[model samples]
Target chain A: GAGVSQSPRYKVAKRGQDVALRCDPISGHVSLFWYQQALGQGPEFLTYFQNEAQLDKSGLPSDRFFAERPEGSVSTLKIQRTQQEDSAVYLCASSLGASAGGNIQYFGAGTRLSVL
Target chain B: AQTVTQSQPEMSVQEAETVTLSCTYDTSESDYYLFWYKQPPSRQMILVIRQEAYKQQNATENRFSVNFQKAAKSFSLKISDSQLGDAAMYFCAYWGGANSKLTFGKGITLSVRP
Candidate 1:
């Protein structure tokens, strides 16, 4: 599929363990986004990257959470010392990178992480 | 900060019937966009419909439409002749041109009964 692709559709991690989630945006897409969706709640923004530069990351919950799009095409969301509160579905989306904020985002199936 | 509110957490409707989901938002910007996204069991967020605040005419796509009231800051989605495939979680989102972040509501779960 030409859509955004995320690795490890599901991940189970133990407390204090470190985990990394990867996302591959559509080819040529300039904008990538990350979101966190918990049970019964809407997705909250995590971070955004434009090409190789991370433009926005204020949505990240804490310092323990880190995201990087070093090469611009693939992004990784890493968590250090996972906790039960960190368990949620992480979604990745991409856009054509047109005008600033008007482009529609295409989403991936998302990675569901369960922390115990 | 922009905030979207979805009062109804869950709703049920018979297949082939019409259902309306309500959403309200708070924003100070004049030019913005309202969107409704559907998330199925697959966890894929699909864009259903969108409305520009500057436009008076509502936006519609096949069986889905939106009733956007700019003055009241309300944007509701109407699904006509709802089908089983429409059963999913719908989220209302607000996007301002000045802000790159999308503000989303809690979302509503829709169930279709045959």
Candidate 2:
């Protein structure tokens, strides 16, 4: 693909429902990141992956949030028992560099999730 | 941890005029990166410009330039010859070397009046 692609550009979930967001990064990107953006706020880091290894998951807000990139090219973010606070835009980005130091991330259009 | 702050919640600039957006960051690490991202109504995040913390010189991309004051922990963006299309939400971001996670500031909404 020419750019990072995300599925279900918009999703509306009732509170306590489980939802999954998918991200298809640019071909061969080594680093993948997940972020959450609340209304009128900047994106907040959620997790990071290098290849198939999950290097950081410190930013995940709670146990309900889980992300995985098993093969390293495609990733999924699953939220269990979604709360109203979970209503936000979930963004996915990928970069060629393994580390963040010199990497320029390419972002997807993001999936706007609304938890009623 | 690095924290980026953009104090201006909203700013307006006339067409052909220049507007400066303010940003300040707090970081103890000597080596890192600063970035400016623009998100239009379409909600696509676009990279505007970037500056390396180790470099003394600023960064420029077309009509976008950054005034990076390493000492003051400030990285402000200046948009020259602004156009109506430049209207968007601008964010300042910080990336610590060796980490993929980026810390971003509360964005500033830019309005370009024609």
Candidate 3:
């Protein structure tokens, strides 16, 4: 599909292990975003990237949660020393431009991570 | 900080009938955007509709429409001729435009009874 692509639709990790989730945004998209949605809850912003520059990452819960988009086209959300609280569905979205309506995001089927 | 509220945790509607899902928001900024997103079991967040705060007229897309009351800080979605496909988790979101992030409300699960 032409939409955003997230790898490892489901991941199960042991406590204290490290896991990485990948997201491939749509072609020509200038902005990309990451969100975490816990069970029965809405997605909360995690981070954002604009053409290889990580513009904002304040939404990350802790230092254990890190995200990067070195190439601007692909992004990775890595959680170190995972805890039970780290379990959630991570979603990736991309938009074409930076304007208001232009920032309407298209999302990918998120990666559901379970920390046991 | 902007906050969205979806007080209803779940709702059900009969197929071919009409239903309304309520949403309210709190924001100090006058210029912003409101959106409705649907997430099925597949976990894909699909944009259903959007309304700009500056526009006084309500926004409608096909069978979906919104009663956007800016003064009351209320934005509710109305689905006409509901179908089984409409069964999903619906989220109301607010975007301030300054930040490239969306503040979403705890979603409401909607079921379409056939």
- Tens digits of lDDT, candidate 2, A3-88: 99998999999999999999999999999999999999999999999998999999999999999999989999999999999999
What is the iRMSD in Å for candidate 2?
1.0
Backbone clash count for every predicted candidate, in the order shown: 0, 0, 0
Give TM-score, chain B, model 1: 0.98
Q: What is residue B55's positional error in candidate 1, in angstroms?
A: 1.2
Real A-B contacts recovered, model 3: 0.71
**Alpha carbon deviation, residue A38, candidate 2 (Å):** 0.1
Off by over 4 Å in 2: none
Tens-digit lDDT track of model 3 for B38-105: 99999999999999999999999999999999999999999999999999999999998587799999
What is the C-alpha local distance difference test score of candidate 1?
0.92
After superposing candidate 1 on the true structure, give the runs of residues whose Cα lies further than 4 Å from its correct spot: none
Q: Which stretches of candidate 3 lie over 4 Å from their true place?
A: A99-101
Of models 2 and 3, which has the larger DockQ? Answer: 2
Superposition TM-score, candidate 2 onto the true structure: 0.98
Superposed Cα deviation of residue A34, candidate 1 (Å): 0.5
Clashing pairs in 3: none
Q: Candidates' DockQ values?
A: 0.72, 0.85, 0.73
lDDT of 1 by residue, A37-73 (tens): 9988999999888898888898999999999989878
